[model samples]
Target: MSLLAARDLAVARGGLRAVEGVSFTLDAGQALILRGPNGIGKTTLLRTLAGLQAPVAGEVAGDDIAYAGHADGLKPALTVAENLHFWSAIFGGPPIDAALSAMNLTELARRPAHALSAGQKRRLGLARLIVTGRKVWLLDEPTVSLDAASVALFADMLRGHLGQGGAALIATHIELGLDAQVLDLTPYRATIRPPTSRPAGFNEAFA
Candidate 1:
């Protein structure tokens, strides 16, 4: 079976349909990049895929996919290391020491998340991707607020995930360096359509 597949997906926000009849299939070890302008349905799509947001229609098929969204999804009161430990506990996964070191966050591990800069929070949020031990990932703007070095580290970790046969659905304007296949939602939309109409049955229409 495909590692990730969104069949007849439909999502909306405040009466706005962000994604309608959107569908895609991803094989194991592959990654797909979801690109569109801000406020478009990138985050919504990622959230739906992650099971964080209920889809107005359609469903996502995959294993236990880990998700990291636009929100840092961190508790500022906790230390970076503590944040990682919290996620690991939730997922019943192992420690993320290596991932932290890869991002050069070892030094700041003990600092409260609130004390970290925006970039640091983003890096801390991504650490869960490494420790989740899941096969699929749903990332929304995974590199936001990151410095160049941190961005590079994010890219490197993506390479590692792909190399390990993981699949990802990344919704971000930033490039992730995975040489990911672009999944543009633009063509699926049209000025004439209301964005609510179900896409004519999937038959390679968007492939």
Candidate 2:
């Protein structure tokens, strides 16, 4: 069975439809790479799928999804291990030891999140996905600030996830050397429309 499916989806940015007619399915042990130029609503589409925002039209059907965006979503005061433990508890996931080792964070397990370098912090953020124990992952630019070696490590971790029958949809510019299908958003670009009146206290700037 498919782990996630999106049909005739339309996602908006700044209160304007950015991409529409987007449809796809992700099956277990599969990975789908979203490809598009900057400002093409890739993040918006991912956010809609992740349930951070509502889609203008269409539907995203599935569950057990975990999303990781540009931010690491880590608590600056928490240690690497503590951060994973926190997420594990929230998601009812397995032990943090495996996630720590997978992201090569075992050595820095006790180090505070604020103490790690940019790459290390990114790795730790990615490590949180493993502890979520969710079947589907929606990642937006997950490789940001990661070094070549770290990127390769992430690819290995993604392979492991697929091996376990998990699925992923990633929006990334760099190549991750994975056997995954690529979906370009150019064909789905929505025609720009006139700005519409906003509701009270609505902020299009952040939308």
Candidate 3:
């Protein structure tokens, strides 16, 4: 069964259309990797799929998805375990043990999020998906600060996620060894928008 899908989708960043004529269907246990150069709308498309932003055109249909963006979404003042616990409560998933173990974070579970390294923070962000119990994951730059060993660990966890009937759509520059179908957004790039169409707030003076 199709877990999530986009049909002729168009996405905008600010007033400019970044991606257009984009379409795909992802099923349970499947994965899709989005590849494109900088400023090509990979993040925009992922945000649209995650429902953080509305699509400029076309349709996206899905539910119960977890979105992990560039930011770790952790509170600097909160401990690693506390962060996971907070999100787990919000999503009503299992305990934090599995997530901590999966990310190899058991040793540092008590450390404050601000005290962790960049890679450790990223691991915690990814762990949130496991705690959420969401079947679909939308990740943007998931491997940003991961080292070779951590990347390998992340790949193993991702494979495990797919093995358990979950799906993922990730926008990343490096390969995570998930053998995902590549969806290059280069061909779908939209033309730059005119200045007049840019979104302006009510506080701004009208032309």
Q: Which tens-of-lDDT digit does each residue in 1-207 have in candidate 3?
A: 699999999988876678899999999999999999999999989999999888988999999799999888899999999999999999999999999999999999999999999999999999999999999999999999899999999999999999999999998889787878999999998976566776766222221
Error of 3 at 204 (Å): 14
Best-to-worst order by TM-score is 2, 3, 1
Kindly give the stretch of ten consecutive residues in candidate 3 with the minimal lDDT sum: 198-207
True-vs-predicted CA distance for residue 26, candidate 2, Å: 0.3
Candidate 2 lDDT tens digits, 1-207: 799999999998877789999999999999999999999999999999999998888899998999999998899899999999999999999999999999999999999999999999999999999999999999999999999999999999999999999999999999999999999999999975444754557565433
Q: Tell me which residue pairs clash in candidate 1.
A: none
What lDDT does candidate 1 reach at residue 93?
Answer: 80
TM-scores for all predictions:
0.86, 0.93, 0.92
All candidates in order of lDDT, best leading? 2, 3, 1
Off by over 4 Å in 1: 190-207
Superposed by TM-score, candidate 1 places the C-alpha of residue 82 at a distance from the truth, in angstroms, of: 1.2
lDDT, each prediction = 0.80, 0.93, 0.91
